[model samples]
Target: MFTFLMMLLLFVPIGITVDLAEKVGKMLENDVPFGEIAFYYLDFTVYFANLLFPLFLFLSVIWFTSKLANNTEIVAFLSSGVSFSRFLRPYMIGASIVAGFALFLGMYLAPIASQGFNEFKFKYLKKNKSVQQTKDVYQQINDHDYIYVSNFIPKTKSGLNFTYEHFEGNELKYKIFADRISYVEKDSAYKLTTYLKRSFDNGIETVEKETQKTVQFPFELEDLTPVEYAAETKSYGELLDFIAAEKRRGSPNIGRYEVVKLKKWSLPVSIFILTIIAVAVSSIKRRGGMGVNLAFGIAIAMIYVFFDKVFGVMAEQSNFPAIVAVWFPNVIFGILAIYLLQNAKR
Candidate 1:
């Protein structure tokens, strides 16, 4: 835990300083207030710390264990009638404490920081909100009602080629079409341009037309145009509720949300996996000393991060299951951890 805290203290400020330098020009151009800029960095620190959590734990374990090995402390402990498994008890206990803290950060604090970080970027750094908006959206608002838009601009709360349909027992009962639709957040209403509606009752049809109309719908602006970072903004409980709601609505972003949900648990579990690997890799005093152990630890950390990112991308882009994608790295590295531990024991 001391090592972990020291790593955080050392790395977080460096990351924040670099990030602030990169964004300072943009913030200055936007005339952002100093208070807001400070808050943004605070959120950034939380986000960066959570992101590099596993690496921090891995490095911490390697550093201390390598020092012990160099001092022949581990040899002394083992020579004093301590089994390798027994020697690992303290490391396991420390890993459990770190894992609990990581779980809390991932499930609760990280989401809030992610939301704030993305919000600040979108609001200040990005001039074009269209980059964050998804196009050709189709959503089922309810069991009988469906809506579609050819193009949506989330910043403007507007869309083009909007169509809404209602069905009764697989029969289209009503349909509404508009050349353009814009949401009025203050009024909780929508303005439709060149609006037309058709209703059918017992094979009889009734039609209505309007050049422009303001109407209330059963959905909000977010329902019409969801930001790509929607899942990142929600806490664990909120994410569960949001995913369930999206599933009922047949949202296309379910895969992404599931990835986020699974990652929350997987990250914490990885702390233990990485801790074991670090201890096994660095517990032996090598001719090259601590440098060799650190190099090996860094390589393993890179591989772990690469696997995580590749699988996460696959899950988001393909039909890969999010749970499998999130846990695959842990499973692979878990096997490595066991192998290393056995070798270290021998």
Candidate 2:
């Protein structure tokens, strides 16, 4: 905990300074209130704390354990007949505590912080209108219902070149097309301009056209719009439900959401793995003392981080399964931990 706290203190100021410097100019130009800016930093703290959690745990374990080894404390304990496995008991216990705390943060607190962070960025920092939503989206609203849009604007709750198609057992039952559509949030209705509808029955087709129409749809505006950070903004339960809903909709971003879900579990599991590795590496006194252990620990941490990022990107961009991507680093490091433990014991 001491080492973790020290690392956090060192990083927090730098994080705050960089964040403020990046956003201050835009905030000042937009005349954003002070309270909102403060709230944003609060969210930033939570987001960053969760992100650096595993590294903090790894470094903390290495720092204190290396000190114990350097002071001959570990030698004394072993000389007194304490087994190395028994020595690892307390580290495992401490890792459990840290893991539980991390789990709680990931499941509950981080989601709210992430939502606020992304909201602030999009609202105040982002100047490009196109960045708000994606263009040319296609989604299945249900098993038999599909929707397509050429472009969507979340600010106006509107889209252009919208088409809704309904299929019944390999047959096109009905189709709706509009030159433009806008959602009325207050009324829970959709306004379609230059609307056209076609109904097909037994190979016969009937068409109807309207200049403007207002109608209620079963789907919400969010269903039609593309959200880049959708997974990050949802709590654990909400995330599961969102994933299920996305599956029903046949959304193309399921891989991203699955990655987020898997990562919640993976991050906590990594705490235990990294703790073991840290203890195994640092519980032996080296010729160069603490510097040797610190250097080695930092290098291992970097390798773990590198593996995490490479796999995470593969899951996000390619056909790689998210569960594998999330757990692969832990699995590899877990083997390393065992190997190191055996060597340390000998």
Error of 2 at 235 (Å): 1.7
Clashes of each: 0, 0
Each model's C-alpha lDDT?
0.90, 0.89
Q: Which segments of candidate 2 are over 4 A away from where they belong? A: 129-133, 184-187
Q: The CA-based lDDT of model 1 is what?
A: 0.90
How many clashes does the backbone of model 2 have? 0
Model 1 agreement with the true structure over 1-346: per-residue lDDT tens digits = 8988999999998998898889889999999999888888889988878878889999999999999999999999999999999999999999998888888988889889998898899899987755444578888887888899999877677899999999988999999999999998789999999999999999999999999999898887777777788898788999999999888777888888899999889988899999999999999999999999999999999999999999999998788999999999999999999999999998
Model 1 Cα shift for residue 80 (angstroms) = 1.4
In candidate 2, which residue pairs clash?
none
Which 10-residue span in candidate 1 carries the lowest summed lDDT? Answer: 127-136
- TM-score of every candidate: 0.96, 0.93
Candidate 1: stretches off by over 4 Å: none
